[model samples]
Target: MSTIDPTGVTLVIGATGTTGSRTVAQLTAAGRPVRAASRRAGPLPGAEPVRFDWYDPAGFDAAVTGADRVYLVPPVGDPDPAAVMLPFLDRARAAGVRRAVLLSSSAIAEGGPAVGRVHRALPGLFDEWAVLRPSWFMQNFTGTHAHADSIRADGAVLTAAGAGRVGFVDADDIAAVAVRALTDDRAPNADLVLTGPQALSHDDIAAILTDVTGRPVVHHHLTYEAQRDRLAAVIPPEFAAMLAGMDRDIAGGSEDRTTDTVRRLTGRPPHGFRAVAERELGAPAASAAAVHPESPTGAGSGGRLR
Candidate 1:
């Protein structure tokens, strides 16, 4: 739908992820060809699935072939995504790829965190590039993460972000923005902060879940050390500490903000926390949680808060 040929394949990295899957669906529905790249590429609804891994260079050429655009998901756990992505980006540029969209977190800045490094370098690598700095995904509450299990089993949501609010955005909304970023004739060429329509505290979230699920849900506020210790059982200690630190920052109201970028870019409003809760929790607990990846927040992300 851009100036580029409509038939030119768009390489979608992490094609089966939270946002990636939705992006692929939207693009394909619009009659665009897509190369859905992932570690275990399988049959998708309307695209070609191809095996691709960021750490593997040998798989890059096949995925990039005849592709004019790409959606990037930086390698998690890698301190420098640029090291892993820059080479492939150069290769894509040489192969006539014209646009790129990188998925980043709102908490990460242009020169700050791991994705931030990639965000700073996006423009220079490709003339048309947009960085999506989305806030913590609402999926963290419904999907396979530290919160979902406890929420399902104990009817409780735990966080160190006591009373601190977050403008949790929906993954589907993020995907719609990605589709535009990859297909629009003119790129925004800037870092866009994506959020839900409103901000809500963890307590508000628990209340919403309780109302929607008709279950007695409670918000269990944990100390920073306790949050870190709980996560340490699953992920690395250093990473758990890092997540706890971010949670502490949240307690200070770090993520209590909303934006209109989603509506401005996608011609639709982002999903509110209430809407997310109703739709996700409106279903049976097991069914709703099954909609997410096995582990939406392990490591290599901002924190389990994501």
Candidate 2:
């Protein structure tokens, strides 16, 4: 528990999603008030649920009302989220929101792509703010995410990242950092690069999966063009291309480094890939042990990434 009780009602956007949910849980556990905002307003144990949508401006007033801090999860599929989010943030600032925290990717930079646009303008928008640029998530391998079903069925993880290693950060660590940032009196008014303790390649991920799940999971490396083509069918062409390029960068060692931001913020080192795999996937794979298929991986549902 924090020695200082952080002030204000925190308005958490995407409260039902990955990092947001965990953030809300931590704040409530700390005895801080939270305004949980989502597309669907649902009952929460220690929060005030409000209906919210980034595309809908009508809800902005109620969402930010009496809320001094916000945890922003910009709408996905908007190639440029700044246009939609900036106006809302302006309204939020006008309504007395003093701090904000954005969920961004390690691959994104100022004006680069996706959350990068928001990242560039964050410091100027709010007096106290932080943009979390996290590497790939470990949840991708355990939950019903882009790679989960494929791994369950095919015993394989397809990637354009040939042998590029990534320090896959756990979502729980991200939530811990976010909650601290949201309520901290002295803001970390900077872009924080978060990662796990060590980096591992897709082949390494497969080996861990095999050991945990007791299945012969392997990594199928694809060419950039091939990977882009595969993703294009599910997501927009431009988005698919961007994702493929990210993979290409990964393959080139862009995300090989690890950071201590997680430990710095949460006062503990991050969970290693193998540890996360064991905690989240080991139990499930053991209950239903069987030989899986060999299906080619494709983007599934274009799920909202945190």
Candidate 3:
């Protein structure tokens, strides 16, 4: 629970989205006022729904007005989001919004690329701020992601990351941390890397899924170009290339570590892949059997982690 008393509503962009929805739920459950912003402005039980489009600046004022804080989820599929986001943020700053929490990716660093530009500019835009650079979401395997699709259809996890490990964190944990960042007496004022309790390779993930679901599952490795081409069929070519590049980087051991950020901020350990799998996958009689720990290791429908 936040010790700080929230005076104004927290504007939650992408309210119907993965982390956005969870963040809104957590906030409302904590008795905090929230304004849920999405393109459709879909209604949530305890939130004020407002229409907010990244390209539509006309609605920006309505969303920012009367809100002291903002949770930013960058526009999906935009090659350069800072171009759209920075302007709205400037408007938000002028509107008296004091705190901002941004959802970014561990793959990208401040001032590095893509949302990194927004990550770099967040501090200058708000007095209190936090940039969450989380690892790959565990929901990718259980949600409406490509990985899940492959799992359901072909009983396999496709990836270019051969033996590379990733500290896949849960979206629920990410939202919990975001809620704290928004409601805490003082902002972290720094970028935090969030991850699960432990790192697991794709092979390990396959084993866990097989154990939980009582079905055989395998990790089908693909070449970088192959994965890029496969992803390009659905998303933009450049973005597909970028995602494939992240996988290649993962293969090179880029996302091979875990952090205590989630525990440090939320006062609880992050959820493991197996727990997420059982809860979200709805596998009957999901087992808690242990698997052999090995090495490391998607673009899914849940949108890029960034």
Candidate 4:
């Protein structure tokens, strides 16, 4: 395999997902060539959407073909992601993809428990790589989740994080920083911890939502056990346990700190939770009321480290 040119095509692994989609949009808007890799190869304006799946190793080469750089996001629900990601990174390197930007979680830094292993192993696999360790996504309250729907209905949020503050980030900002890393030679072989400008507790986030939507939104805290029970009813027990464990970590003051990585990389301070709330919750009853017709309960919101 020949060394990939820096100006060659950039492939986004999870093009349909929140961050990936925004990355695609930003890259395309900037007139950079992009190949969007997902399960489906559909018509995405200004991009060549291709089919790729992490579970199917046969499809990996096709996805990485002729790409210079790749944005790698592990598939959700994989208990051991490094087992899949490490080998895939090897293949991409072998296929001449020189630079890679990996979207890792802030909770899984070098010393952290589960996801740290991947964080530690990534830089060794490629000549140039960047690990994006971002905090909770602001999309949890706007996207397809019980929280978003509940917020639309009852104007309330629920979480197990009693008063633990989180530096929630906009997925768009994460994507923007990702595009810069993938395209610019300045970002290389670094681990960036990106966060919002300020740390805000769930209660603070609720207040912001109320102010943005002109509705009575409140934060309802629950015990870890109660949160686990609520999540287990919808997702698998193991996944629920993983989520509950994260919350336990948060409650223990694991993710309450703030960082300046976003400003360092993007030349702008990270957006605050109130700003995100305004954009997502500004429309008031029109968007929120369309969420659920059957359920009368308000939406639930909380910080989940992504």
Candidate 5:
């Protein structure tokens, strides 16, 4: 791990998402100079917010101007982001950015699957680079999945992974580690697989919710085909297929391990699922449960390559 000077500005791409927003907040709170890049231009507290779009390569150079480090996150819908990201990394390198920290997934390692192709190609693009391989996020329970609605209405959670467990990490933990990689010189160059301290299946999560909220919550296990059919009614066919494929992987025991990388990088154990649910959901869990009906449940597992 090369220790580049940490004084120069760090640019944050995808500065509005769950992890990106938190990264920006943490970096700025630590008194580090930061430049937040997004498609929209606005004033972000404690950082310089600029207009940038991954679809428009013309905006790339300007976004990284005067920055020493960059946090690279790909756009959400690009089936193959490496094609778009490689050229941008080339630009950042030419523009004199010293280090880059990529937000990657545990599912897609250096040639594992769809997004893995991009992961495989990342190391060769920068002198100092670190890939964050994190498992499913704990946010889906309270933020953006149908599970949130299920928790709100029927007091249940749903998944296709019958007994598969996941070491679901908090997005905040991922962001904290990203901030360290962006600013500190001690982070490793190789892929970092981060996970929560413990692995919990959907049933375990449902039990936690039941305990914390004082409501009867249950985990509804569905077949991959059934889950796919349920999601197909609301999402695009391709996206639904991708989701179903992940469920298949989980059911097959692909994501049933834990890692200490979170603690190694950030000097703290990754937050537990219940802690995250409570922090994000808050007391009077009923009021929190009432907020979102369709909260996502199985994020943190990045989408698979088709």
Candidate 6:
């Protein structure tokens, strides 16, 4: 397998976020130089913090400067992020950035939606490029996302997905694939559809959470319009509609498939939902009885795509 030069630095956008943070950590742990970009530019172990904001282009040049490769995470909650993202990407390309790896959703496709437009433009901007179309992140239910908030407050997971199943993937696995795509001697040069080992319904997720946390978590189904309205309360109405439509599509079996992309790329099996729960939620080893004494969980509620 051909490899890219490991001497160049990598700029990680959204460095404080779920996948971005992990990507930065992994890159740095591998003895690679990383410029971690975020609004606050907060400190991360083994990374150089750089202040960056998509809406503000003043810092864009500095963020891309000295970096040869970049990991892209579009600004969250913006209905049309391409408007701002495209300009910065052009700047990065001109500033000597060569490789780019974008974090996109499995529900979206090239030229399909928000980040999809970016996915379509990536190849034209950089000769070395990859788009990581990862399934809904398992971090959504563990981090500060709406699903996790509701679970902590009311012990319920809300969604319009009904009984449909999704191949929920862990954010760590997404980051692992991203690191490979960025640093590998060869750029993926293609969109990678990432998913965990198996498909799981929301009920299975709730049961896993209930067992792990010992808090009796449950899935609370809602109508499409209701889900949209609920999400609109916090995010833009258009973005909220888009998110609810994903749920509607889920109910139609759109996200029911799984992929071996993670294992194929990372050289190991992806983590299961139960395993993610046990690790992220601090579940004891005894709580592994939730899934027939065997298995192992991403998104089920209103949250920004990260």
Best by lDDT: 6
**How much lDDT does each candidate structure score?**
0.81, 0.83, 0.85, 0.76, 0.77, 0.86
- Candidate 5: misplaced stretches above 4 Å? 1-3, 285-306
- For residues 1-306, write the lDDT of model 3, one tens digit per residue: 232347679999999888999999999999999999999999998999999999999999999998999999999877689999999999999988889999999999999778999999998888799999999998777655557667766778889999999999999999999999999888898999999999899899899888787768899999999998988888888888888898898899999999999999999999999889888654442221212111011335423442
Better of 3 and 5 by TM-score: 3
TM-score against truth, every candidate = 0.90, 0.92, 0.92, 0.89, 0.88, 0.93
> Candidate 3 at residue 153, lDDT?
64
Off by over 4 Å in 2: 1-5, 284-304
Model 6 TM-score (2 dp)? 0.93
The digit string of per-residue lDDT tens for model 5 on 1-306 reads: 554666789999988777888899999999999899988956789999989998899899889889888988777645577778888888888888878888877766687654576677767777777888888777666664446655665787767888888888888998998998888866467788878889888889888877776667899898988878877776666666677777777878888999988888888888998888777665774445444434334332223211
Q: Tell me model 5's lDDT, rounded to 2 decimals.
A: 0.77
Of models 1 and 4, which has the larger lDDT? 1
Q: Per-residue lDDT of 275-299 in model 1, one digit per residue for the tens?
A: 7777766777644453333423333
RMSD of each: 3.3, 3.3, 5.2, 3.3, 3.4, 4.7
Pairing residues by index, what is the TM-score of model 4?
Answer: 0.89
- List, residue by residue over 169-250, the lDDT tens digit for candidate 6: 9999999999999988989999999988889998998998887777688999999999999988877899899999998899
> RMSD to the native, candidate 5?
3.4
lDDT of 6 at 286: 34
lDDT score, candidate 5, position 231: 70
Q: 103 in model 6: Cα distance from truth in Å?
A: 0.6
Q: What is the lDDT of residue 16 in candidate 5?
A: 76
Give one digit per residue, the lDDT tens place, for model 4 in 48-98: 988888878998898898998999877765556777777888898888888
For candidate 2, what is the lDDT?
A: 0.83
